[model samples]
Target: MTTTAVDPAKCRRCHRALTSAKSIATGYGPGCAAKIRGAAKTADLTDFKPAQIAKATELIEQGGILRTRRPNLYTAVSGDGNTTYLVARQACTCPAGIKNRACYHRAALTILAAA
Candidate 1:
């Protein structure tokens, strides 16, 4: 009989070694998987207008996005020294976000987090 060697598994999100059977099967660590799922849910719920999507895509292509230590939170800095915090569930600190409107920061965060 021929023997097969099993390769070690790693999380798809964090690239960490997945020693647990469940994690190996899912391809993501428990924490990472949970975060990804939550982000995906948020992303699905977000509605991005055409302008917002264009702006978000430009920001992402320009590498102007920054992920914060807090989960589901991100800081986006513009070339003009303007900074906006995209808080999950909570509204962003930008003017548009403060007015209860979807901002480019939120759209950018949704795109990045979903990825």
Candidate 2:
């Protein structure tokens, strides 16, 4: 049987070099992968709109988000130069968040934090 090649990149979650082929292919160590799976299982996505999910995914892909020192805090900057804070299980500083509704910043943070 043929075998997959291992990559020289580090794990996405732990920032350590991946030695296993499965880890290299998945971009996460086995432990980290399990943790991410658990987090994904516990994530609540029912409140997010399809547009918001898409926007969040785009923001993440474009490197427009960052996690803060606080476990539940994140900062997301939009292309329009607007900076918003996403407080975990609390609220975001964006307009939609201020209106007591789910926002893209929060959604993006949720996705990032889970991973």
For lDDT, the strongest prediction is: 2
Error of 1 at 56 (Å): 0.3
The list of candidate 2 runs beyond 4 A from truth reads: 1-12, 16-43
Please give the lDDT score at residue 103 for candidate 2: 83
TM-score of 1: 0.54
**C-alpha TM-score for every candidate:** 0.54, 0.59
- For candidate 1, give the lDDT of residue 38: 57
lDDT (Cα, 0-100) at 101 in candidate 2: 91
- Which residue pairs collide, candidate 2? none
lDDT of 2 by residue, 1-115 (tens): 9999965777766789988877877666888767755654466767888788778766755556666777766777864866555555458777777899988778766776766
Candidate 1 Cα misplacement greater than 4 A, ranges: 1-46, 84-86
| Candidate 1 lDDT for residue 84 | 51
Number of the top candidate by TM-score? 2
> The CA-based lDDT of model 2 is what?
0.70
lDDT of 1 by residue, 1-115 (tens): 9999887786655778899877876666888767755554456534778678777756654546666788766777653656555555356777888899887777777765675
